[model samples]
Target: MLRLISSIIFRLLFYRFPQLAYSQEEIEEYEKMYSKALTSKSEIKYSSNFPKLHFIQYIASTKKVVLHGSNHKGINEFEPRRQTLFNGKYEEAVFATRDGIWPIFYAVFDRNKLVGNFRNACISSDLKYNYYFFSLTRETILSNPWTSGMLYFLPEETFEKVNHSLVPFDEWISKSPVAPLTKIEVEPEDFYFINKVSYHNPKESVIVSWFLYKLRTKFFIKR
Candidate 1:
């Protein structure tokens, strides 16, 4: 009975909020662009000068599609696997995000070259902007051999929200295997903050690094 009630509530919410539902027209247009990008050998740039939350808002308002980014290529199906987070929490799922810019970070970086990596997405105090911070060791940047990555476009049918309170519109997970409709190749230059990277010692506190990054972004907007 409770499950049925939940399903009804979800249906009501989705009906009341059209953005929560998928749009086949939007998906078709995106796939067409993806094909063009492939022929041109160019990145399908999604990064924007606006705040990250704005991108999330645009996604929720305009078109809602699940996105998964990876450093690998030629993956027809995404299998659910155990993933360990920076906080040590473990889950067996195929993870994804609705925020277009966030996935690019995962798509561009070479995971094997880094000993460790940390990232966070936060909203500003005024709630008008969003911040995304990432940390990596200097050696990781220098040693990374690959200059490109892949971004997978997925349907939202088999996905569920992961953290409704924290990132209600962004984080998602699928417990079953998912086949992507298509994928686009991307490069580091495709990310808006690609030039704003901060290399710190792995031993340093991530909190400190994040704080410094905030300051740098505030003081040095052009850099």
Candidate 2:
């Protein structure tokens, strides 16, 4: 049949021209080149001069939080709305807050010191005895190479460099529930670099991650 003749001719041609058969190394090289070409098409290049950011982890205690009024000083009960208590335990509660809560005084950690900021602080969850400061964006984590197991605090410079159309920090604050702003004195020693092996991955926007995955899938695979 014609099919059999074509198959025989194809084999004979390949046998006559051994170069038609690629070696393992040659096939691997071709794949590498193809992947490089595909990646380069949409690859984002960050500046080498971009300053590296550090992650901040605060280790807290269960001791009652004490706040002082103008003339009165007393132990304050954790706000029920701001915290979540275990099934029956009242003393233990998680102090979790969203990315941008405006009019909120945040204790910023810059290397060795805990600085104060009215806004633009990267503070994350408020779980018992552990306060997280670095939050990763869906776009940055999935696309950017620098983002790793250790959540990189979205520094102002880095934030500006990347695309912000997904979830802008200001957008969150605009929709956030109004809360009274109060300055809290946080000790420098209270925070330290959280061990990545133990620290959990920083939460990212689910919607954003889904959207990016859908867009990048074409570049990643061909149907």
Which of the numbered candidates is closest to the native, going by highest lDDT? 1
Q: Give residue 42's error in model 2 in angstroms.
A: 52
Best candidate, TM-score: 1
lDDT of 1 by residue, 1-223 (tens): 6544544433322211122333565455544555665476554555434333233334433454678779987788899999954445688989887656667778887777776654444222112233455555666655653467888777778888665443233567888999876566777776665655556566777556755664544444232
Candidate 2, 1-223: lDDT as tens digits: 6544544433322111011333465445444533453355422122222111110111001111211111111212223233212122232221323222111222322222222211121211112111212323223223321211111111121111111232211211111222222222222222232111011123534333333332333343211
In terms of lDDT, the poorest run of 10 residues in model 2 is 54-63
Alpha carbon lDDT at 150, candidate 2: 14
lDDT at position 191, candidate 1: 65
For model 2, name the residue pairs that clash: none
TM-score, one value per model: 0.64, 0.17
RMSD after CA superposition, every candidate: 9.9, 24.7
